[model samples]
Target: MKGKGKKLRKREKAMESGSVEDVLRIDVQNLIVSLNQDNDGVAEGENAAPELETENLPEPGTEIDVKVVELSSTGDGLALHEGSKRVYVVPFSIPGDTVKVKIFRHVLDESYSIADFISVVTPSELRDDSRIGCKYFGKCSGCQFQMMDYSEQLKHKKRIVEKAFRHFSQLPPELIPAIQDTIGSPLQYGYRTKLTPHFDGPPSWRKNREPFTSRPPIGFMLKGTHQTLDIEDCPIGTDVVRLGMKNERARMEVEYGNYTRGATILLRESTRRIPKNESRPSSSPKARSKSPSPLPPDNAAVKVETESYTDVKTCVTSNTATSTEYVGPYVFYNPAGSFFQNNNSILPVFTDYVRQHILPPPSSPSSSPSSSQPIKYLVDAYSGSGLFTITLSSLFSGGSVGIDISDASIKYATENAAANDLPLSRVRFIAADAKDLFTPAIRRAYPGDQTAVVIDPPRKGCDQDFLSQLLRFAPRRVVYVSCNVHTQARDIGVLVRGLEGEGSKGTRYSIESIRGFDFFPQTGHVEGVAVLNRVDE
Candidate 1:
């Protein structure tokens, strides 16, 4: 019986470890069968449609017909059509333009399509003939609006933001501004503070994946394909960040026997200096030997397990040669196997916008020195690493509080507060769920003190409990920071309606302001900030 059970378990494990090709083959076969059933007894002339061709694939300049459906947040139309299975096209076409598009490359499952707008079948009055500025405009996916006029881009972004708010929040239109603008980037180029280069070769090409034989050559993955485009230059990253990646790639080729598969490389740069000995150990003894004496135990770099598609091995490279960092005051990050804002240049502007909108105006007489009132407090809910909380601590002299569900975030926020020289007594870090902590903690901390709540919720937005708690507390101001405007709107709807079964006293807050920031410029994602004030009446 035990032997039989072991055999069955082994069989199940084998089925679970199927390769990508195996899965694709099954899907293709099923699709082919479905097509055959859909068109039974078709004539040979009609059935002899060009065999799906993979050999001598179209070059970079080839054009094909594409149909677009959805417009990416960057205003690029995402094309979807039948017959051309697993294909998506982003053309210079507007929402309704159906024209010939050139296929850039066949990616893993879909084709990356771009258009040659020689003629518009159905032209809209909104379409303009403006030329883009950036030299690497067409190839680089960083800025989709490069070809679009600034004013048009703003209009498109505003429409997208407003639509999301209306569709998701269902709030009155008058409550929010159509759009909010921060000081635009003076010099768009060389603004990014961090850059990460990906390799498509063997293990030897990476510090952690060293000691392997020849594999595919190394480079960054092309925007639309699984194939890597050998990148010699990046227009956006700082010289030091770019140089560091270049040096690391060269060193990998020399140090390892050959580029091996399943290895990743990490390159990070920050304005905050990594003190001597805080750097990770180097793969090369020569590199390690040159560094200062061993780091103190307290300052040792913490070993955190990073999740990757494959087992990740890391090596550190520091460019001590660069005296001054990038041109702006920004936080640069290249997190391994995760999503992060790539445009580090505009981060300060984005952060400052949120801070200014959430914090009360300095000129308010209620907060002035002549008044003998206690300063109001702010709650930074879902505070990740305490970035917003620590930065805005100066607004509340009596201190403020931040709560997050993530244990790592709580620990980081605590350390960050101490690092920023904020009085620990004034700043309380609670490692608890935001929904559970807000109402009870506020009630316990101050029975009647008016507070302001700045919530930067996750993409899905707040839960029922969270909305309930916020409504219960009825903070003087609720600054909602959201990545998804739809959910933000839905949550706001619940908050605006207030508790059920209660007469007259229901609607607790009134929407005062709504605005959005284009944090992720090239993508369809948007970040919205909404301010709601408790209605005393």
Candidate 2:
């Protein structure tokens, strides 16, 4: 066996260096000889009947070469062997290709095995072209499908959503229309409005054994890894955000002398206080002794603050101060430490879509009774910083309510409302759990007469109790904004089923429309909004 292995290796090396004619000559002769041997072996075995080919069977953990025959629901490649029971799922692989894979994780109960591809035996047509602009495309892990063409990405995302809706809810195909893709951002690169870059103590600080030695490096966390990737320049971040990171890095190096390790440094684009400073120990003796470094007269950091006509003020901290004031405008606010959509140009379009669906055009007088009231109330549940509530407030003369669990968000929402001159009585901001706020008593306090509820829950979807209360409240319309489609479908299924139940007899809410927003382009993530309207009894 060892001699045969060495001979094979030598032959492979010779083949690599030999001309095409030479390789063909060898193959012809080898095939002729192999045919003769095969004929002889078949003749001998004919009389005894063919023995089972046990000798060639693979061991339990041994990997085998296979051609991907299909794609899994999650877009993984699936491969199978004709006579074998084992099946493999190759990540980042497409169907209609051959790949050499090694099984890494296997469970007998599961139908498919997870594998890591060793090499491509046959490449698929779906293999993506190399990216043109960004060098950090793959390594950054910020965008997975950037290499794929934009059209193809949209098609795949639509298919993913459709499949999730079909498989999870078993909804009729006609009930779910093809996902509507929003216009892709014009500035595909360098379009991010915000960025949070973190840093640890400087190298010199590490050498000095200073008080702060465990600070994280200043930059985005490495893709999938806990280690920080020092980001001196990030193409996706806005200019001001990038500059802020650079300034923060310089300040940390100058003041801390590189002593910190494992500490997180924050560089923010908004005039909103960069969160990193708040993270520092407020009462630490060391903090008291350390004074913030002063900026040079010409090098002062800019700050961008905006106040809406309704009295909602947004303070964004950066290098040069930029402010905008308007009434009946949308203001997006993400958690101080969480990711949020940041495209300013498309903010109006996105909000307009939500508003239209939440409050459709008023019914003609001929279609309804003379006393029918126009939609008046709007409830922006999970309203972070009051973007949805304040922006949509203009549509209703009656008023709106914004509810959230974050106190910081409530403070910002109230200030934002006040800044916009939306009378305090017209819009009330509540800092309470959405579930607690959606109870029977609370719903009664804010009568459902001509009410519309806009719910933008986290990825996990709303809690069961909250859903139940929401169904009981039975707003005239519901605008569900979801970041994850699978959970969205599940929650929608629950709502649909609840509407069919006894207590919900007169509260049926049909899914009027659904649309997909490519907020995080180049990545598989997408945001969707669904409109549901109550059926009059």
Candidate 3:
């Protein structure tokens, strides 16, 4: 392949550590393959036949050595099988991990496989537990990074955010601003306010595991299996939760055979409210704790409630989490198990980032009595539980509108605004179809130089109709919030290539910045926010 009379030398530099760009691609197959190649033992498709017959495929449940080269968005590791014709995913694995795994695949599909970890052959250098490690590190399915150093985990998460944006945007990395460092939780391990510990009926009660015992054991489901790991304490759970479960476990032994099948216990920790100004924009502002005193061990409660949907029984347990908890000055009615952000530690930082971009500081008006109308309106298109609009309504001088496709969400918003004591004159909430969420009154109220729209859609990202309407409305600024960076980048791409008035020009909004908030720590999840500014023709 070398073609040169002068013999040009190839120069290669070692890739910087943890650069996702060098190893990941947008295409799923390519991404899996590249990550698989990063491992040492998983030699890529050496000298194998082009296609293996059904009878020739590797036997299911056979243990083999595989190296995890990349972590999936959901925290699984991507690896490869022999001949490299198919890829396998192993959970509870980090990149650079060489582990023995038992392989299994769907009967009809030989193109993919799933692996269960037998033992770790070589642990990744990123793993750290120098001070102390959790005994449930491998057995429990709760926390993924108990072995990883906290700082290293932060670095990897930032890299994950950057990688996702680039891959989904399908653009050069230079276009997007460098992702900020992951904001860590003040309480890394014991920050969780709620826990759902479960137990399965023994073989005696269920007749599944040969002779069953009828004792209800409490804890998390085992990694890669339906089995539950009995736990007396979980580090990730709050002290309040631990004490609640501890008592419940003792009670379970006394009242044995109460559960005929599988059952779960819900433990919730009651928390105090904090005063609000919690603003973190480009800067990583320190989030203040609500209570100067420590969390009381006895400030916890347990209750059981059952809700059925889609022919499945779901149990939810909630504590006295309330609407008075302030994120900035806004009071959100956070009913237990309703979608208040999980990590209380970084919530102020997260909300402030959203507010800063959505409501920029007021600037001096244009000189010479400019004819251009200055934007005074703010619209929260996807106002879930009214977090954005209520918190920001007072910031906008003219007025604000909050719209939601779900009537329940709008109702919650109304209740929250009233609880926050925000006047009806200052802001209003509307329930309408997302396609027609923005009303003409919005244009009338805030018709000018800098109107802002804040949107936080479900994990799938904003719908196209909403996006198109956003373009037509052409707000001066748009702040898009998403937990899924890939979908966010997809939406960003569409926004970047938006059409101008009557298709007269290209690109209407300039991407101002892309930032990540570490809303969830010790997990794969993160909240990403992007700010886009409309360009005047």
Per-candidate Cα lDDT values, in order, are 0.53, 0.58, 0.63
With a 3 Å backbone cut-off (N, CA, C), the pairs that clash in candidate 3 are 203-212, 204-212, 373-449, 374-449, 375-448, 375-449, 375-450
Best model per lDDT: 3
> How many pairs of residues in model 1 come into backbone collision?
10
Per-residue error at 205 for model 2, in Å?
A: 16
TM-score of 3: 0.73
Model 3 residue 465 CA deviation in Å: 1.8
The positional error of residue 67 in candidate 1, measured at the CA in angstroms, is 9.4
Off by over 4 Å in 3: 1-28, 31-57, 80-87, 106-112, 129-133, 170-174, 198-217, 226-231, 247-266, 272-324, 328-330, 360-375, 406-408, 499-507
Q: What TM-score, computed on C-alpha atoms, does each candidate reach?
A: 0.62, 0.67, 0.73
Candidate 1: tens digits of C-alpha lDDT, residues 1-537: 445434533432333111223322332333343445557744333213323434444565676555554454434665534454433446455555555656655543322334433334554444443554445444544455554555565556666666555444445766545555423443445544456566565434456655455433444554445766655666555444565566676776675565445455555443323323435533222233455434324222222232311111222344221111121222212222223344555667767776776654556435323222443677888876676676676777656888888776676567656545566887878888865876555666743235678888777677666765676666667788877665676677667645533222343666767766655443344577777766554
Ranking by lDDT: 3, 2, 1
Supply the global lDDT for candidate 1.
Answer: 0.53
Candidate 3: Cα lDDT at 77: 75
Cα RMSDs, all models: 14.2, 16.5, 11.5
